[model samples]
Target: MSGLIGKKIGMTSLYNADGQALACTVIEAGPCVVTHVKTQDTDGYQAVQLGYGEKKEKRTTKPLLGHFKKAGTTPKRKLVEFKTFERELSLGETLQAADVFVEGDFIDVVGTVKGRGFQGVVKRHGFGGVGGQTHGQHNRARHPGSIGACSFPSRVFKGIRMAGRMGGNRVKVQNLRVLKVLSEQNLIVVSGSVPGAKNSFLILDK
Candidate 1:
């Protein structure tokens, strides 16, 4: 398959063959169940829907419950559609980490980053504050200075990097090398860190 839904297990240090320790992120990849398959004739495009993470039946809605029932699987918390696959997949078929990735493969990861609420320009846009602490700039140390033009434009421009909310964005980190794949555990170790908090869902793309 071109991609799989996974959870960020966390970061750890792994030693390579050259005896160098490398920082890696461990992801609990599928065991994703195929929930739906769309073909060219039926949907105008080819795509396969995969579901991950278990959900209690009582928490599921009527429409979603019926959808899972059609696939012959229990309720799933997250459902994602992938447009590419290595082979044809039937409904309710399971895919693990071994199926989509292997060691030495380069892939991209998509996830939501941890949120930092109500930040300033210093933290959000890397602006080096307003003035030095040596002066009487107490609150101005973290302030965003000079946001508008002097009388000519007369208004603040759009897309200025003044901070309000920060992070919690859907970010894609690309070209992470796959370090290890544990099929039995449905886990894959990848070089470098991926975005998001622990247990947050991530899309691993080839």
Candidate 2:
């Protein structure tokens, strides 16, 4: 529902009231501008499209430039539609991180995990591989071993967790506790790690 477009600012440790160190991922959220508003009577749905970050005019498409122009805002790097909002907002209005979230709130962060390129099963799927070095195991330590049956199935089954491209998948981390909110800086700190590499875009939803 209510959400904001943000960029991953990496992770840091914060000391809590009990003196316990909490690991949290820092995100630079919002100052997002409302680009479009979809109404039920017109678009058959209720949603608000928010834009965050800035892109060079040359790098942005012409149609998108026209869209941003209609909103009275510069070109934005990201655009996301949210179904729910705290209150009805007008187009071209800006929202900061503190407007949508607060400390101690539970939110979901959606992001893409870092791509690991082509990976082997041992690292990608956590296969233990062949144990021990004796018994003519040789270099088959990290091999997937038997993949298919002798004759009954004959071929490898679909959806098998073999080696292939790893990571770079969209991941949703839910119920992340909001540790701190710096409204002035447009920053939010949440407990635990979030997906994606530093500077990657993320969607924080409530």
Candidate 3:
């Protein structure tokens, strides 16, 4: 289970050998520095903590600054721990996109979806609403009808799907085929759309 921190660089189309256009999401992956190597004896688990993206020293906390200093790396914006790395790595070592992924590799991407703030059932839960514009229905076409039962059970059931805040959730997109890897640019092109908006941080793992 090798993984890297990345940012969604946006979407683009690629032409295959057959001249068919393939939609793909471009990600700027890695160039991550290993900040810490946790061992079973020290931390009860084996994992590698990697740091990616630059951060201003003033914005970094004292504790984190010390941690980065110990690793001999500059401040980083994102830190993530990954278990089961492909190879043993030492602190301060760098991991690039090409080191972990290759074209035709299947990987999983985890990211936070774009936030939609407050949303309606029609948009959030795919509810069809009232379904008709007639039958004395005017502004109720998009309303969620009948949320509760008659006096007996009376209350809305727990875990009922209603409109509220949507998106901005951690989502995992699995089995995304790696279409291309630009090692020099630390970029990877993956098949299909991934979670989150452009420039959003993501975790790419295999």
Cα RMSDs, all models: 1.3, 0.9, 1.0
Clashing pairs in 1: none
Best by lDDT: 3
Task: Report the error of model 1 at residue 86, Å.
Answer: 1.0
Q: Candidate 1, which ten residues in sequence have the lowest lDDT sum? A: 130-139
CA lDDT, every prediction?
0.94, 0.94, 0.95
**If scored against the real structure, what TM-score would every candidate get?**
0.96, 0.97, 0.97
Ranking by TM-score: 2, 3, 1
Candidate 1 structure quality by residue, lDDT tens digits, 1-206: 48999999999999988999999999999999999999999999999999999999999999999999999999999999999898889988999899889899999999999999989898899999877877677678888899998888999999988989999999999999999999999999999999999999999889
lDDT for model 1 comes to: 0.94
- Per-residue lDDT tens digits of candidate 2, residues 1-206? 89999999989999988999999999999889999999999999999999999899999999999999999999998999999898999999999999999999999999999999999999999999978789988889998888889988888899988999999999999999998999999999999999999999999999
For model 1, the stretches where C-alpha displacement exceeds 4 angstroms are none
Q: In angstroms, give how far residue 82 of model 3 lies from its true place.
A: 0.5
Q: Give candidate 2 regions above 4 Å deviation.
A: none
